[model samples]
Target: MVSREIRASVHWGVAHALPTVFLRRAAAQGDLQARLIRVGSRGTDEVFDLVEEIRARGPLYRSRIGYVATSHAAVRHLLTSDDFRTGLPTDQGPIGRVARWAAPTTLHPVEPPSLLVTEPPDHTRYRRLVTRVFTMRAVERLRARTGEIAADLLDRLETRASGPVDLVEAYCAQLPVTVIAEILGVPEAERARVLEFGSGAAPSLDLGLGYRRYRSVTRALAQFDDWLGGHLDRLRHDPGDHLLGQLVAVRDEGEGLSETELKATAGLVLAAGFETTVNLLGNGIALLRDHPDERARVVADPALWPNVVEETLRLDPPVLLTGRMAVRDTELAGQPVRAGSMVTAILGGANRDPEVFDDPVSFDVGRANARDHIAFSAGRHHCLGAQLARMEGEVGLRAVWDRFPDLRLETGARRRETRILRGFERLPATLRP
Candidate 1:
């Protein structure tokens, strides 16, 4: 599990980095909010402990400012239920004391809505536009290209092996960023610029980020928005098969997709596409190091690489928690929820529910029920990049094994400071000397 000390330099989720919500409203901010909300800051293991306690109480339990769903049954229900919506509650209501922080007056690049935030008619429309393009079929087409990218990155990584290497930074983090950049048709020269935005602008999604991080996020978003505007203009005149070109063509088609949606969606793809997959690779690699028995299995068969990926996802998901708001008065597991209520779905807890997964904490590569885990969340807002992420994980992990079959984690491996979506900032590894 990753730590919750994430700064702007490590991970940021664009629109999701921060929000005016029932849950995070009480969370500690960097002097951004006048009142502080106590969301029980804890390390990874402790957080999981709390999740177990909460789930044991019942499917739905009251949290700092809202309800937290712990059971897999409850979480799946809330996620798939039309009663719960994607958007957060804008009004502070009873929690206004901790919710009244004034963010930057400047226009944020992450706003004007993306698929990650909007609900109903808007989500329906925007989702339809990209559904066919982002489907498993579409993502599968990139498998060969992703493998090539993974191979090249692994080549550079292996050559740099003077001693122990930070696999997370060198290999895991680099592959997805490069792949997403190319897929977006970001010019080779401008790829770094996209990376700058993707890496720097993520804290905007975390309401708990201190004022320092918040201010940094504000600046990053402004810069990202400005550059993206120019990038879109260049693509408008000369479209390609890249996602940007496809979106630009959609804009020209005059059917749907607003400029705001285009910019937000693009930012979402860059930040989200890069960050979550980084953690997946990091966590998966770390798991292999800890579970050499499973490692040996994959090392022998190689055919079990996909199984390794699935089990890794089950044991240690990239995204630990997500939010959903009640669109109308409803009951979850017999707990009454008001029309405008919110729930923090403890995904980490759900994945480990004894009811769903036996010995859920144990990392088993051959676990038959591994795919049943909702590491990607479920229902309407399921991760759009799930298939693509799986492909990258398989390709990325296999490359590591192929290049360094004797690879093992170095002593000083470090998890990222992110609480919501767990990952690593520095995961050192070395082939046995």
Candidate 2:
């Protein structure tokens, strides 16, 4: 149980504050317990305590509002159910409190809309367009390319293999960017700029930053629009057989994507397809190095690739969380949520939900229900690049294992500063050649 004072403090001071500050305090306090909880003014402090409790106890636990907000019935209503649709509390303003506060540009201030942001029609439309190129069949075409990229990266790692190499920078991060760049027909020179802009634009999803983040993202979007527009123009005049060319040729319902929509769609595809997969590969490799037994199993039996990928996703998802606005005044679990409130679906937390997974903390590649995890999410907003991501992981891991059968993590591992994309900034590994 959490202390009442702490609960009250978090409820009053933390709920409405900037999430960065809130998470900072929470991290500093080292009190991240509770599962599937809400924190707001009034009784929201309890949510923080609950989060801490969940962290403390295991992966899953119940949450309750502070003493003042609701009855025992209301508390029960919020918990003991999976109807996340209703549990979110509603906003009470014109712009909608969440929209005002949780601007995408403010939280990350960098990075782009990589499937985590955007809702409904826009999300659906963009997802549909990219889905055509990112399909399992389409991604299969990249198998040879992905293998070549992995082999080239490994070759580079071996050549410059002095001291401790950051596996992330050397291999994981580079692989996806290279692959996606080729796929999207982005010029080699512009790849670095595209990555920088995408990364800078990602943090805007945190609801606390709101308009501030949006402004920054808009600027980045403008740059991406300009750069990609020129790229598209070149592709139009001299069409290549790449994914972007296909996108340009696509006409849905006799209505092709507008110039702005095409750019936005391209931005989304590149950002999501490249960044998240890079992080996933990076994180998965790190985890393998950390857990030797798992690595040995993967090396011995490449057949376990799918399960290994699922377990990796379960333990460390690339996209930690996603946001959605309520379409209607609905009840989630048992909470009263008004229409248009912001909801942060904790994909990381949800994947580790004990009720859904056994021994959630442990890394078991062979876990029976591992595939049921929501690393790709559910419903209309599932990742369009899911198949592509899986293929990348399998190819990357297989190539690494086949090339260097005795790879192990060096003494030190450093993670990236960004929390939204969970992976290594640098993972020093020794390849036994």
Candidate 3:
């Protein structure tokens, strides 16, 4: 039987989703021994593999927390279904006890809601505001700037002409952060602080942080929020032609955004922008080095870079799993879901579903259906930054490989030790000819 504590915690929005995710994961592994698959204690690379193994066990498996939808059919349906929502149907407050139960037994105040964990109206509105910035037309305008950023980073990496390079730090990590910081018009002096705070708060998306880490994240969020408030205020006073100025205009027009919404939107954009591309660059480069035939093909014909991008996404997406809650009693892939109970949809499994792609396990850049993979997820909740992320990958990957024809892995990468974000902590490589 589910505890009343968890029941309350699970029923809310973005401000509460992390605790709910933590509770469900903890309960799923700790007590609900019904078909325990040992998601806990696995290394970062192994975690996605484990999810894939569960995915192979047919489409839908009833895990302790709601359902684990792994098949292409199941994941796509669950994400797209109107019956499932990112949050509970109601705001139903007084959830302090629930937060304590989710984390350690300590009081936690509600935080600003992110689009990731909000339902329609709220989610739709925020999505509209963000989509205005990332439409293909808008993203296309950034192409020249993004390409220049990528080339500059790669050029710097080339200066290291000899010895191993920590590409994760020197190239992969720096490129996306720089591009996003520029897009937001972040001051040159404050850019480092923004990413530093971003790095601290990022783990809020995963489990096993316990209380201390959660506290640290809360502090970072407040600091980032403070900086964002000032930044947005400045943009409002003198609207430029940048995305920040555009967002400020959105906020000032019509119903306009509340102070909370303004801050949350900026924070969400910053959070969404950085890590996805960084990890994608790291993962894609590493994959290219490991597979020389594919590497040679990609470098030999850079036009195939998009195909390479698609394949890398399908094989190792930056985000491994996403959660959805049942808004009303409904069935997913034949499993009955009760309202408010959450489901963990394993994207890694869905991408590799045999039903969707032939030779699913092996990475095949030429696979016709590579683009079909929902690496950015599906439905209204799909990544708003999808176009931007692809552009970054397209520019970043090809630039590095094309620039350094002899690029290859130097030492082993240190995986992030996280299950939710399947990526690397550091990736080392060589650019010697």
Candidate 4:
């Protein structure tokens, strides 16, 4: 165990600390992307302003880290083009060698076989299995279940003894976790534990953490890994008919994922399945409450609820940005990009590109092109649960307003501090007008 801790420490230095040093220095030198990353978290308006600053520089801004893509066209191209692939540029140095050797073997979203980092072939295979079970039709079928879950949660919210209640804790978080737990066959008794694990492990996607926080995150990850292994083992012995059970049974062509692959895939799906939607629900609720005029517009036109979700996603995305590395020397947005260069696509910024939408930052529920925003990302790496997330966001937010049309946000709503993912950690609100 001591040796494991040593390895993790060494791994953190190479994987996180080294880059953090350069990023902090670059941030100090006024590099917009560097500042954005090094700060780790920022207020909504300020973060957008920083992204716009990078955009104002040109289509692509080069920072000490690599290139940052903010324009709608540039970001779309960076995400969609074959020249760029997901994951950071490989480090082929002695430090890289040591880092790779010291890295933990835990199943994580940033690691291989998780689909987030895996390219074609394996990615195609794993995605195929998941898509078979997580299809749009499958998601659409769950809409009624999702709405039912929202209604049930609101009932609990209504029963709470008065004063400001945290909407994130009572509604936004519970609704999606319950829905996803049902989808993944997680027993109701174990749902809270799953949520805890996801919350603890979420920072694994970010960069540059202090050692104390890093150790905590690593422990959480290991715990989640052990729990999932047990869960999957139980499923293997007596698999049910749910999506994960089907995955366990190797439903697609009988080509099952190995235990590590299965664990990686399941962990990613479980965490990602709810985390982003948690952000989406919270962001949508806050956006609607803050923009009562648009909220009223949607209330009058019940059919616009779906559009409301799209518009919210456009104005304030759940995810801020994603990074990709150039697979080969290539050109992007008329600029030459060399092989191994990294391009950080600021999804939040791209959604607000003036070329795509009018008054890009304003919350417009009726915006016709709101769906054009790539909040779920694009190309081969598009979010597998996009439809499910949209369904949850639409149903969850509408349910809140439908149940309590006069719901008022309190003064203490707080945004989450994770660098890539954005949303509220706590959203205090009054159920009554």
Candidate 5:
């Protein structure tokens, strides 16, 4: 019998390493999609230039791995079509079987039972229960609390000694985590641990991770699963008035999530609750700082704050790309795609589709159609926390500038290395000019 670590290593090799090797060779051969996967932020110009190159190739271009969609219409069709489904590609043959068998049963965003991958009637059931508690009204109610949290976090930043501080860590990450923890009824004391686990596991969303990072991510997921199970068990006995407690109540009172489903749902909620928002906040601050003219416009009129958030999302989305597998033979944007083909949707590229918005690459905070970008995705799998994230972005960003209108973005900002999730890992800035 293979040990758990050995099994996980095999799974990583099959799932990640092989793909990395294929992509590297393809990238060297000038495969645009493969190149996009390997693109970094030495400067974002190269990323966008490659995206435009893919766009120039037409709506749906075939790459070494599979189909690549960069056009707004094509990407929207892929995301919203019933002929396609979400999740990783289904491996075939004996080695593929071993890879699947070796995978440990953990609550992963990409794994089955998690809303990211499940299809109806299970998907419908899980979504309905979660939506009931995580409604628009519920998010609106928390807007005030979110503002307060942002203000408090900025206040702490202001008190720190005058020097370059990593805003991503000190402010961007803290505000949303605090707000989400309050919503989930997670004790304040455990929020730091939650953030640590989230940071460790975040790279799981990216592709082609090295063995060291893969091992660390799997370990984080396993530990997070253990902690989540105990927390859910505690909630079972005393379901409080929080969103997670309500989910527990729903689970106990007849046709609802099983123990495994409950853990998966709750864990996704916890990790996703802040991860993207952290990216959004960081991206917004950087965008505003870089475009000082726009920052001045926002400062002159506070009502434009929400639009700032939308424009930031449009210009630099947290999740750079997502993919869907063809469920059956289908035609997308007049192109024939056979069954079992994978179509990668470059969300960032689609957001810059020249046909959608005039001067698509320009950072216009007042761009009327800024909200039309699918930064949160589309169709059934649209981000469940879209409203919450928008609120956090607006409030968190507004609080930062409101407290210190002359905040200076110092040199040495660094972007997160993950290809899929785009944001700053370190945004050096001084609170006062």
Candidate 6:
């Protein structure tokens, strides 16, 4: 019962496949009390049906979920909900089970035990400790540094041979890594290696790929741990102004974080900080390239970069999915969800929900509610680096446009194979020098 308008706007590209699978799986579960709602290319009709289904069956349901190969809902539900656990035993069998499994050790395992994985106390504790480091004030302080990084990147991009340049590699990918390295106190010379290692650690279920990434992540983690551990020891003797130095000084009645916790926290910050920001920059640039009018508007008024970034997140978020595990059977949106189920909140899909956003498909940089988008997520576990990411996006995009107002996308834009993190692997563009 999806609406024609929504259906018409359906992006039937490869990206839509996986989410569709989850929707279909939920529909096919064969549970009499639970029904799966299908919203096809019919737009409002489909959305209407989806709303009715949610109202009738409740938000949480018990069924063998089938998902569209690339639907946003499928991925979001898989990653962010308690009704579906990514790493747990599921009726989906080996292939299905392995596909969703998230290991703390893996960098990109179709799933991973990130801050997005755990719920309640663990999530609460981790979030509380880390949240302080990424506040608006802290992010504001980093603005100057972020601007410097953006300028350096633009300089590099400008100097590149005037023909088609891979924007993703030349500018998007490098900026965030440099920013993160500076924030984490990693030597500039080591930033590339760290990025390489962090990339390898990302979760990809392909056994060969996953194993290789795991090894790279492990080795990198060891090196980072050793370096940070030594740095912490020194900081205890002589403190500095960086995050790691500050973390070492924090204490709760003389009971501070264990070395393991510190290392894990630092690693998480480093990996999440740079990777997500990089994708955001890349995705935003690509979106502007595709939407010339919007790009022109932003270029004409650099202040609109924030809104542009926000709209880009709503339209094509870098982090496509996030997950949570159910501690007990509960009713969500009315449906009965068993205890220990996984609940995936479809941020991307939800952000685009026609009921929530008017003209959801169009990229409107001036949309009043653009900032309300769930790109940084919601609730207690919302992204700690939200402000930092925004600063990076605003400053980075402004720099790009400022340097080359006539930047145009060349043919052949391919998104990376990593579904969890949605972004371009390569984006060739011509900059008018």
> Candidate 5's residue-wise lDDT over 393-429, tens digit each?
9989988888887888888888887777888888888
Q: Write the per-residue lDDT of candidate 3 for residues 270-302, one digit (tens) a residue.
A: 877988887899889888887888887776777
Model 6 lDDT per residue over 243-276, tens place: 7667777732255455556666666787788777
Q: Give me the runs in candidate 4 sitting further than 4 Å from their true place.
A: 251-254
Model 2 C-alpha lDDT per residue in residues 276-315, reported as the tens digit of each score: 8877887788777678888778768778888888898987
Stretches of model 5 off by over 4 angstroms after superposition: 40-45, 92-95
Question: Residue 413 deviation, candidate 2, in Å?
Answer: 2.7
Ten residues in sequence with the least summed lDDT for candidate 6 = 7-16
lDDT-best of 1 and 2 = 1
**Structural similarity to truth (TM-score) of each candidate:** 0.87, 0.74, 0.86, 0.97, 0.97, 0.74
Q: Choose 1 or 5, whichever is better by lDDT.
A: 5
The residue-by-residue lDDT of candidate 4 on 1-433, one tens digit each, is: 5598789889888887887888888889988888888654654557887888888999899887899999889999998898999877655578768867898888778888789999988998888878865678888899998988998898888877277899888888898899988888888999999989988887888988768777878888999999998998888877887878888888333577887888998999899999999999999998898899999999899999999999989889999899999999999889999998999999998999999999998999999999999899999899999999999999998998999998889898888878999989999998984
Q: For each candidate in turn, give its C-alpha RMSD to the true structure in angstroms.
A: 6.4, 8.9, 5.4, 1.6, 1.5, 10.2
Pitting candidate 4 against candidate 5, the one with the higher lDDT is: 4
Backbone clash pairs for candidate 3 read: none
TM-score of 1: 0.87
lDDT of 3: 0.74
lDDT of 4: 0.87
lDDT of each: 0.74, 0.61, 0.74, 0.87, 0.86, 0.62
lDDT-better candidate, 3 vs 4: 4
Error of model 6, residue 176, in angstroms = 1.6
- TM-score, structure 3 vs. true: 0.86
How would the candidate models be sorted by TM-score, starting from the highest? 4, 5, 1, 3, 2, 6
Q: Give the TM-score of candidate 2.
A: 0.74
